[model samples]
Target: MAKVQFNDVSFSYGDKKIIQNLSLEVNDGEIMGVIGPSGCGKTTLIRLLCGFIKPETGSIFIGETCVFDAKKRINIPPERRNIGVVFQDYAVWPHLTVLENVKYPLKKKRMDKKQMQEIAMNALKQVQMETYANHLPSQLSGGQQQRVAIARALVSSKELIVLDEPITNLDLKLRQEMLKEIREIQKTIGTTIVYISHDQEASLELCDRLAIMDQQGNIRQLGNDYDIVMKPKDRYIFEFVGISNFVDVVAKEDGVYINAQNGLVKLDDKSVLENPTKAYQLAFRPMDAVFDNESPIKGKVVTETFLGNITNYFIQLGDKQIRLQQSALDVMKYGKAKEGQEVGLKFVRKFYYEKEEA
Candidate 1:
């Protein structure tokens, strides 16, 4: 296993900077998930780490070895970096059988034929593809192909593995299964892994820690799944990661007060507000609020969607449209609320941030 570190790493393509003095670390054997919107430099970071592209500045280290150091002009080739990568497309050769594909990476190791075959078989067994050793890529399913690709990556002495949207091509069931398998294999082998994806749900499920990158090519937040979800650092991170309702508020010594057109709500945490009389943004998740008949904050329901276990309502109050999600059981208990019905909203919890001035 290896620990990867990036110190002031920066990269750019032509005139556009993709990564701006980014610095982070992934500990040995830890699975770190890198998540961001498209064009947020997640893929570029992967490329820079794997030696596919050299960074314009800074250094990258794997364990004690300096793989890429701009100051020293040290640039190690991808094969010598002792890292394995699984791409979104699987990237297995159609002409090679499963066993051959797995053994291909080991061909340069000067091992005997039997030793190479044994190592390849063991790798395939780790991915549960040993029985299909002779099958060609054309004959295997997408999931099966992905397994072979993983087996190929693990067949060598790689200390770190980079998975770039590895499960994106699979169905929902297969994706979930693959996630379990990946986690299990990583634990068993104790290989440090970097998982990059645009899917937040998958990242939340599979990562030991998450690194959220913003559109400005910088790390926005780095923490556990719950910390990132429940306590985002700012408005941009909160809105990018999950659903939130924003209301304008006035700051005060005792609390931050929300002055909605139809009602008022006060936040108990005085520290959230920097000063009195300044406008703040009150952000809360859909699950944090409820519909109260007597609430002073009112809205007209524009649409109601029944999403299996939960129901979502898009309500319009003044110039803003707010979303609220409630359990189906709650809807049943309260009776289904109809569209066009004006309903009151009560805040159960909220997050406070200083409003960005336009």
Candidate 2:
């Protein structure tokens, strides 16, 4: 419906800077997720987009309208921005019925009572909460209350919506169902959405593209889930996206070698390292490594954990402990390794990164 753009936006709270020279664009009719740990300014971005706070520099655009521009001195109020917001707590009025809550936005425009009722009922139907229009939020379940809040937001602004950790309080099953429902609604109406959350897995499941932020409030990477997970741009991205293992590695005349408990074990694939002369560490995901008896790379199994879908193995390589995962099917095919067992490791895929300073 509408594309959102932030051009060289920067914000600060007194002496502490939150965002700096951040530029990003969200395409029309797509779900763009902004994910990062707490204190990374995810909420600040939402506030800036909603016109609740002014940026120290740069401009922001929604579709063709310049909502906020520091140089141009153009500032649009939040009420006039026509951006809907859904919060994590399901910000529904407990006193009002579902229909009344949805109609509250239309009341500000002084639309006729009948016309407002019709629009509100239509929005309720869109979220599949039509039958409970007369029910109060207190009478509804957590999921149902969320649906009411979503309907209210839709009734207010159909073009652009911001969902800030909307389903974080819900149970696991309810969270999944809510995500599915949101996707269905988006597909049907083609509303551009900005979903902000710290949950990486949920963001991956719901978003079309993800923007990952670091502690300094800078976007480290922005791409699809596969690229962010498999082809991370830096060590921070790799460690933040999923479970990762980093082992100290040294380059030798023969090949690259991983520092092991017994001695240095030569890596099977020397081509993984782009620059063998520079200091680098071997980095790989838990699912990327496999136990091989013939491989020279070895580790002692410190512990083994049986998760429902996958088996987790904690292997001690020298003094550092790393994790490896095997699916249930894999365990059925190849027997599980015992604790304290010396196992040979072969990496199916690996990356080399310079060690970060402490």
Candidate 3:
């Protein structure tokens, strides 16, 4: 399998800069997910890697080969790069049978029919589509069609594959099944994958490592799911990673305090405040906050939603509303808080950030 590397990569579209001085590496035999909001250069990054578009500045390497170098003026074409691509649309030819679709990539090598069939069948087997080899894509489900696309990508013995929102078109159940299938196939073949998506849940569940990009086309953070979620580098990363609540708080000589519905409530930890005189935001995940009757911080329950496994609560503290989540088991034990109920809040995990501008 090949490792992909981008060194000081910068790309622009006319006057608009999409990426700037971005450097990231995808290790061999690992699923590296690049996730961000829409128009965050995720697609542009993939296009640059696949040689569809050249970067304004920087070098790209696949394994040991320098596929692109601005200074050296070396660029290997996409076909020669031996990189497989599975797009969001499945890209399976509707007219062709599953086996034919898988064999299509091998045809350019001028292989004999028997050898091509053998390789194609092997690829289909890897994706568990061998039984439906003769079925046309129109006859297959969306998930099945996606498998055909993946098999086609793998048919040419491609060690590196790029999946661009591959499961976005599938239903929720199909997405989960496809994710499991992909992880299994990766383990079986050890292909280095570069997964591009805006879905935080999918990327967190599938990727070995994640690269978070911002709208400014910068790599904000790169790490595992746990680190990126629990130890976010900044407020942007925290907010992007999951459902987050940010409450405005003022740092005083006594301690950091939030303007609760009752009055000012002192935070337990004063060390998190960066400046004693400035206002900051206390950011935490919905799951990290709990209702505690003894805590001084108070909020009125604006709404409570039972979302299957968890009970979601929107608590109004002063003028700001923040979300909190409780497990169904906890709700069963302690009973659900009613609307308009004034509840005490205790934050289990929180981070401080400069208050956002109005």
Model 2 spans > 4 angstroms off: 166-168, 272-279, 332-334
Report lDDT (CA) for all predictions.
0.84, 0.89, 0.88
C-alpha RMSD by candidate, in order? 2.8, 2.1, 1.7
The TM-score obtained by model 3 is 0.95
Superposed by TM-score, candidate 2 places the C-alpha of residue 143 at a distance from the truth, in angstroms, of 3.4
Best by TM-score: 3
Model 1 TM: 0.88
Per-residue error (Å), model 1, residue 11 = 2.0
Residue 83's C-alpha lDDT in candidate 2? Answer: 88
Between prediction 1 and prediction 3, the one with superior TM-score is 3
Decreasing lDDT order of the candidates: 2, 3, 1
**Which lDDT tens digits does candidate 1 get at residues 1-358?**
9999999999989989999999999999999999888878888998899899999999999999999999999999988887778876545889999999999989978899999999999999998999999999999888888888888878765589888775356787877777888899898999898988777877789999999999989999999999888889988888877787887776665666666546555544555565556677778888787787877677788999999899998887656788889997667655567899888777777787778888
lDDT by residue (tens digit), candidate 3, 93-204: 9899999899898989999999998999988998888999999999998888888898888875568988887535578888778788889889988999888876788889
